[model samples]
Target chain A: MLGIDWNFAGCGCGVPQGKDVEVGMRGLLVKDFRFALQNKKMMVMLVVIEAVFLVMQGAGSASFVMGYMMMGCGMLVLATITTDEYNKSMAFLMTLPVRRADYALEKYVFSFLCNLVGFFLAVVPYCVLRPDRVADTLYLAVVIMAVMLMLQMVMLPAQLKYGGERGRMVLLGVFAGGVLMFTWGRKVWERALAGSEGLQEFAARMAEGIKGLDAAVAGIGAVLLCIVCFVISLSVSRRIMEKKEF
Target chain B: MLVKMENVEKRYGDFTLQCSLEVREGYITGLIGANGAGKSTAFKAILGLIHTDAGRVEVLGKNREDFTAADKEELGVVLAESSFNGMLTIKDTAAIMEALYRKFDKDYFYDKCARYGLPVEKPLKDFSTGMNAKFKLLAAMSHEARLLVLDEPTVGLDSVVRRELLDEMRRYMEKDGRAILISSHISSDLEGLCDDLYFIQDGRIQFHEDTDVILSDYAILKVNQKQYGEMDKQYIEYRMKEPFGYALLTKQKQFYLDNYPGIAVEKGNIDDVMLMMTRAEREKKL
Candidate 1:
């Protein structure tokens, strides 16, 4: 009578996936939070670590060094997750009436939650310690998210294909090497400017000009990048899983 | 019928498993095949664990791929390997499954655990292979499912445990509407429990018939080769003939029985049928 076709393909087996049928993310939210209920000890342990990290990074002024360390931790967690799914725990979960799409969505959303918690903790110290840099703290939040989102883009596909151990190793190596090279380039530029009187003044003027743009633009860019990566990853991973053999 | 696979075809690299099958309600159907013969692959496809390249799997008249959580709750599975998280105790796994499956039966879970002497407090990792299989069965049975899919459920269990598992499955079907699809290489179990048998070979269903029908229809006729040389090859599924004598499997056992009253018409089992079919299937390729 409601004209809702129980046989509707879009609802269960249709062009519009049933998993995407509603605004309600109860399924996603439930699984992301299931660890809290299923393993209370582990949840308590993670919460304690977050509080400790927040205290350590007070004034939330996270350095590039802090960013690198968090990325390493993220890589390690993703590795463990992928190994559990592929070699160890997958057969059991797959046998149940769980959908592949829901499974993939949980991985992406939960890992993002992990990064979100880490980023928030990193800035909480600065937000409370240095109220003046609250705005900077917020900006740091966006940048940390951008870096994590990019890492996810690399990890999800690799984990889905080759899986955890090797994928994380490659991602961490690539990221660390790339950042180190950039640091080397920056230090070389600093030495070049220090060696020349004219170049020093010119570099100072350029730096001032570059810093004038609104920090809000960085936030906007990071948010947009995250949205794009999340959407593309979800779609691509769905296709890969739909066609995957096991 | 509880489960039906129509013209199913699955190919993984060089391996292929093809068959059309149906499992009626109130009966246990044993999916018999050799190792690497695609029995597990077929069961996986039926459970929607692995997607078949072609064909449809229907459960309770609804296609398996179209199932929801509610639908899945009514269809239980006990894979060879336990699916419960290693860190979780029997209680922990039971609690999680209870939350996840709407029909999860708590009292039934405890009763079965107590009956089987499974330690609810023991971490699942500490259980032996036999104990693990029992717990998996307990979890599945707790669902009170209309259909149960078991993939080599008796793999590591001893003969006594294997019989106990089969007996439990049989008791579950006493309600007269439930069904089960059991895939195992153990032929004696098939003989003991299955109402119907499906023999798969080389990815194609070479033979599928009633258990009693096969038992009555086939016989190991021991006859002198000189006399058997003039017999019809069309009726012979297999004939191990030599200069001394011959042992043959004929579909028309009654015909041979009536014709050669003096010849031995020993009964063939589900295992003998499997051996003959798989052997003949391989000999065809050569």
Candidate 2:
């Protein structure tokens, strides 16, 4: 009987219940971290590349390093999922004490933690080389982090739903579609504006409106949007996991 | 009962598994069936690995669907076709187990690994099939789970290793609350280890009997055509047409022993029971 407290905090319904959930979550997190650690060679290679870029390009390469590391951190989550799913090992993993919901939550938490570390690690060159622009660098970094978080939100659910191989294909399709839409949308807007003064005036006003937007408010808006996406993605992932057969 | 599956049904494209079974506390229950006999399906249903099309699967007294993380903590499992990530070392697995289970016995795990010649630092991908099977079983038992749902836990191993694993299973059952629901193609293993047996044939539990009853009371009566025509058919659970004449499977061994002195009655084992229970109908005309 392992001295486990089987109380469930008096709630008998659904998963992610009681203190045991946290313990199981810790276990799940550790497993993923270990999985990530197994790619130590890749991690070191990335760091070496960033270091060379820093030495060659100096502080100008800070944002590049930041974006690179943030994405690398985010990719670790996918790698863990892929490893868990490798050779149908997800079936074996699900048999552990951790519930499916707990598994999803742990991935989300681990992703955020990894991205946080990436953020801090990536900003070191900027802090060292261009301390004067620290405030602006911090602001830009926050925005990039928000974008990275949204990417993560999209990624986690996709990986959970479609698994590793198909999930990557889906992600590629999504990015390609977004690029196409943006390109076609800009051409359509230009054509429409060229057709009328009234439309051009409206466009001018829209550009002015955008130019006048407050930085802090936009930052807050990005953060809020990331939060909303995070919530939605988390809910979707939980559903995918709960309904998953293995 | 630690696990109860009542008419639990699962359907693949062409295969449908309908099973009813129970694993009670302090007893080792063996599920004996040929390949594709729904043994794995039944275990998966009990573990909530797959969604059942109908009926109920209860584990540790809660419907499997309602098994919270805490509830699942009481279950240990080893799937026939899957195990831990191959990229992980045994040490990494041990660390993960220590985190995942409050009752995980790290010392016990290390001790077993040592005894079994498993290297702690080597990745699981480097291990042989027999080593992997041992590791999976050790991981399942490391958690001190009340119920173990094992599907072909002894599938790939030598006789000596298989014997050692079975011995470990017996040692695991020494605890008062522990129980196991194991399936194996090796009938000799189940016959010697299991408290009771369930014979599944094509997704249905065709026969269920205590292991003692199967070993002690069940018998296969070999008779010539003349003797077969004259012998009582009421006690025959299954009958197979042999090249010589007829091989009758009966639960009432004493009934035939008393009446048919001239007939040869062979003591029934799991392989005999499974062979007769699953394939006899197809082989026997009447």
Candidate 3:
């Protein structure tokens, strides 16, 4: 929410431009687009793959597919976080008028947006395909947020530690490992719960009990995770750059 | 105080950068150093972009640590590298800047951009490196930032563009309240632009003084074969090279000029003075 009031400062196209850091951001964005183009092949490939997965997930109703869609989207968004380094965006970002604080905030906001986009894209189509079980989509969204936050928390500190290319590599490696571990854990828990008929029946009867508990715990946990990850990211980045020979 | 650095030191394992620096309210300060001389590190410390281990920096009567958000708002800074977002247009960049500063003049930014022949619709990526460099300077200077911090703004520019940027900086300084700190490798620009300069070698401020004083102080004596023996050895800073004989670099140029009236003396430029002051540092490594 950049509260931009888009009234141009009276068009003076013929006159000399102004002095300020705001104009610098224009140049920065242009360079960002250029960098995207430079990696056009990979970017196009990623977009296409994401689209294909979303379409396939829309046709599937299995719980495993739902988990895959949510977590997959989270991973897509995670890659964007460090792609800027490949494009050398960090160097350009520093020269602009924007302060380091805002720069760090962008990562948090970006991660959140990516999770929302991924969840809505895959979940909405799935719900439309099967109007009867749309409630599952809500759980899917929650799962999306959790996965994105979890991945960001794991990858963020690495981004700060190595930076640019090396940082992204480490982040990806850790993220991949995390997704595997989390998926394994989720599968094992789901099987264990399903194996106990008594627990499944109890969960169904006490659905209300689980709802309140889930809301309270998940809400607080998400908030705490977001805050901690953000602060640690800011702290780690500040340390790497602080008195750095750069 | 306009700007002051006391007992500032940064360590890079093998080398150490230690110095004390001051900049008067109405003058431009130049930080000079050869490659790996810690000029960039010193600049970063002054901007508070990087935290320093030991020392204090004061700008515009506010200690570097105590300077509030309002104080930072008053300062306009541009470093060797950029600090802006990439996806935003030039127009969007300006809008973001407007929020950060109370003195941000939007009209001035567009006006300067149009004058520079920069395309507002085009992103910074479309521009050449030199064009991008100019845009960087434009962004920093557009804000009525009380203090301007520049790190080698002219390193990659052609002579003509460098001069244009230099003139803009000089115009900024027309207002006595605005101060500038420029760090550059090119000696000529600093020789003419800065009122005061600090020569840094191996991360230390080896010499600091007025340009005019240095100009008139260090004399490159062109002595005849006979007068080499009679010449004042104490005044000679040291030998430039074995075969070329010696050239004296001094703070007391007027003394030699006044006393050795007959001896040929040449003015020592920024590079010459830097070479003289850091000669020992260079030699010890060799």
Residue A191 lDDT in model 3?
93
Candidates, ranked, lDDT: 2, 1, 3
lDDT, candidate 1, B1-286, per-residue tens: 8888998888878987787888998888888877777777887777776767788889877887776545665778887753766655787766666656667789989998988889998877788888888888878888778998888888788888888888888889898689988888788888788888887766776677777787778777778866676666567777564355866777788888777787777898887677666564455411
- TM per prediction: 0.78, 0.94, 0.75
Q: Report the C-alpha lDDT of model 3 over A185-239, residue by residue, as the tens digit.
A: 9999789888999878876778876666867687788777766666666555444
The TM-score of predicted model 2 comes to 0.94
Local distance difference test scores for all models: 0.69, 0.86, 0.65
DockQ of each: 0.26, 0.61, 0.14
iRMSD, all candidates: 4.6, 2.0, 11.0
Poorest lDDT segment (10 consecutive residues) of candidate 1 chain B: B277-286
lDDT of 3 at A114: 51
DockQ ranking, high to low: 2, 1, 3
Q: Which of candidates 1 and 3 reaches a greater TM-score?
A: 1
lDDT per residue as tens, model 1, A39-97:
45554554466456656765342555346435644453364455346325666665554
Whichever of 2 and 3 has more lDDT, that candidate is 2
Q: Which digits, one per residue and each the tens of the lDDT, describe model 2 over residues B1-286?
A: 9988998889999999988899899999999888888888888888778878899888888888777777777888888889989999999999998888888899999999999999999999999999999999998998889998889999889999999999999999998998999999898999999999888888899888899999999999999999998888999988888888988899899999999899999999988877786668787635
| Model 3 lDDT at residue A208 | 71
